[model samples]
Target: MPRTPRSRSLRWADVAAWRLRRHHLRGPLTAPEPWQAVKDVSAALCGLHAQVMSSAEQAVAARTRLPDAGAAVREALWERRALVKTWAMRGTLHLLPAHELHLYVAALRDDRRQMGDRLLAQQGLTPGDVAVVLEALPTALGEDRLTREALAERLTAVTHDRTIGEKVRSGWGVLLKPAARRGLLCFGPNDGRNVTFCAPRYRLGADDERAERSTPTDPAQALGAVLRRYLHAYGPASPDDFARWWGTGTPEVRAALSALGDAVTATDIEGHRSWALRDDVADMAPAPTGDGPLVRLLPAFDPYIVGPSRQLVSLLPHPALRSKVSRTAGWISPVLILDGMIGGVWKAQRRVRHTEVEIEAFVPLSSGVRRRIAEEAEGLLAPGDGHGITVRFA
Candidate 1:
């Protein structure tokens, strides 16, 4: 019989450790060896491809090894053609890594295309012209960064139009995406303003032309890989959670769950269902102790929170918490994760003295725990500059 995801006794420490290591300790993404970390945690973490970089001062105060980690993570985001947007899960922008990017985008491309097409039509671009422009991009961008103006020139040249401003901008997104997929280009270094697209180290040569382009194939194997990894990190979860995370329907989720029958087991949780990795539950490794030096203030859209299913209430149950996560408008608030499992919610503002962190908690923090949280927050913000940390009980 196919088992559904049910609740089980979860070790908060283990969960915290897993989340931390996956994000922080997996090593810097820019290191040629970033993929090593990806492959290492491949079985335990999924869909969290965005890299989180911290300011140089923040890294020094926090005493982290990968102070420039965020840049690496961003590169990882582009390398995989993972759309660097906030809409992957529940409208939170995440730097989704490559593989998951391909899958989700494949399923979503048409929906996006419709939206893109509608916008283009409004800008006076016809389907035939759109096709022609896309075909001209390679030659248009040949051996150059192809800034907006440069791209416009190329489009005007092809269309023989005195004014092709809207036409160029309209086809910009369409051409750039395919260019990225073909490994011909990607986002270059950020100049403190907008991120400009540039060519990758290696151009797409003729030898690569015949190979099948990347496709988001949700094979039973791939789905099984995703399910097993989730169970390993956030185990004893129900299919509903899986469905929500994958953004797929129940039948697809069921099939994916079925594919992992041998590697997982179901358990009961307060009349609910979840699944756990059979191996981890039986022989889960003990979390290394002795107060590790690492501490992180993960941004709101950080994968640790976003990758799991919608039933996050299992871990974070307050409705206010939900509101705080969304308050940023477009930016994700920084989360204070002392030892994982959301020690508290923190908001930061640029104050005259320094950055001010307004912290709210669901439980009353003891002096010792509060001290640790404060110390961690200090490391996160400017020195002695973070204050106004309030503690409220749920």
Candidate 2:
């Protein structure tokens, strides 16, 4: 029988530092930025470090601090070649910096490319037909937005293809994934729903055009680079977590972990084995949330909610927790971050000019914490902010 992995207790403070500093907040937040800057900075505040947070919390935080906070985030967003999204890393979304996009997307593309061949075979799409569909995308999208229907129409015209729908989906994946790999296109602001496309402003560093051109686009190389970066950023995690986040086979996760070698250290979480940066244990601490303070109204998908494992949430058990966070739904209900862990979930919606938020607690709140939660909710209920606050029990 295979030996079971060991469980190591982790310092909650270290977990907080990993979630706040290294992963999100890549650079100091800035202002007067482009859409790209806004997207990237929002990502930093929300989760460039981890996808545990929902996109809704991201929007709240982006708008919460007004000009100063929003501007800083936008400034950081535009400083990259492309921001990586829709590839690996929980198979959700992320806004990677330009210099790093290539490595991140390349790994994901390799995984997808393998699936593409299988999908293509199942769909009976000829290579020539697929190529034709792919070629038409850049022009179809042009420098303008390409809605779903518009892209479908353009693909049909270019390839004279019968399966316009499937082709559009697959071919767009081919184009966007490579663009993500090549440092060209990145996530734009949400067009009310999902992300739209925009060009990236690349920082080529000191490398000349030739040197930049010489950089490899091979997917395996990208995967290797990504493995290194993941361990570097979120070390002391288990191969299971990495596999879940990256959507790779166990063999692949193990191989990558093995390659990391001394750069990482293995420890047990409770009884389960996990990994961490070799020196990270000694170098980090949990953020000081001030003495006797416990209540915080974390936006939906707040980093504190989704970034760490359930074990980190001392008040609740993992399998017993009920709030579902699904990627396809595109809706993230806000939650109460009590003592730096999820206490329950909430949501805010507009009634004409007024905004109302509904709060549901998994456990009864203390009178003091409840008051603080109301205060935090008030941030979302400011006058002229298009909302008001209300709490209800589940």
Candidate 3:
């Protein structure tokens, strides 16, 4: 007989402890090789928020010992083809494991359709027009890397609609998004100031032939796989949180959860209903209370900040501080997290000789906290970029 899964009621502290463990912040930080660490963290989070290259680099560096993390990430993308940059969850640019691209695309298939419809409607385009672009994308990209402008030109030549060319070159990502969602397009090596795109399969070359054969073909299973990963890393979360993260409807999120069956168990999180992987419930045992406050200098759009959990926001010292971390116009500033709560917002300006970091605390920080913040800033600097690091509280 199958046993009924046990229910757990969680307080705020439990969530914080789970987050620390899941995010790899509480454990020893002996770092892995740069590329391996990037792959490990990306897979752990399912993907890394990568709208800004610098933010993505810092996010990875926070977990690993890559001094020049940005260059290392680029090596993974361009040289090794180990990571892929494309439009992913919430229709934002993220760095995902290259081989798993199909799974993400399959999971978001419906959401991408809805997004496509809205974007096309705004542009006064029909589904047929999007279909045309989708058809021409693979052939247009062929085996060669093409700048956005060059690809737009080629797409224009194929569609024979000059307006399509204009839209592609507008840099708004409307026309190209569908291709990325369909796994037909991804970043190519940049061409100076211009960004380029190519078919991911072409980018992977012969390696993709083997991957495609082994990749799961079922979309429902793919959706379930992505949700399981989400719950594993960011679980004890509501369907709304999952919906917000994926930019999908609640129906889809709920359906995916249902498909997981016994794998998911219900929980009460601060009086609200949440779900988590059954095994994780045991791991959420309250952490020791004696340790001093933990501090992290998280970069903009770090997963720890960008994850769609209002519960995390409630951990802020004050409600007003929310705006500082979660800014207007999709600008999430770098943050100072002290003891699992948002302590302040921070910024770093790097020069050839040194990096200057300025922190604005919502609450006064002690000298020990300030010293810890300075140490965190030092880690962000490249080797021999000078021992000079300035951290001033504003």
Q: Pick the candidate with the highest lDDT.
A: 3
TM-score of 3: 0.92
Candidate 3: tens digits of C-alpha lDDT, residues 206-238: 665676677666776787788888888887888
Off by over 4 Å in 3: 1-6, 28-32, 112-116, 205-211, 289-291
The CA lDDT of each predicted structure is 0.49, 0.52, 0.78
lDDT (Cα, tens digit) per residue for candidate 1, span 170-246? 55454355344333445554555544555543332332222214443445555566567666666556777766665
Minimum summed lDDT over a 10-residue window in model 2 is located at 23-32
By lDDT, is 1 or 3 better?
A: 3
> What TM-score, to 2 decimals, does candidate 1 have?
0.62
lDDT of 2 by residue, 1-394 (tens): 1132443466554554554454333123334444444454534432353243234334434343342333434444434433334333544555455445545555665564334556556656555554564466555555654555555676566666658556656554543444444344456555666556644432334432344354456765655556555555555566666665566676777776676566666665445466776666555555665644455565555433444333333334353554343234543456665544456777767577556667777667777777777776665344434455665455
TM-score of each: 0.62, 0.68, 0.92
Segments of candidate 2 deviating more than 4 angstroms: 1-64, 67-93, 113-132, 135-145, 160-218, 231-234, 284-290, 301-318, 323-333, 380-387, 391-394
For all candidates, the clash counts are 14, 29, 0
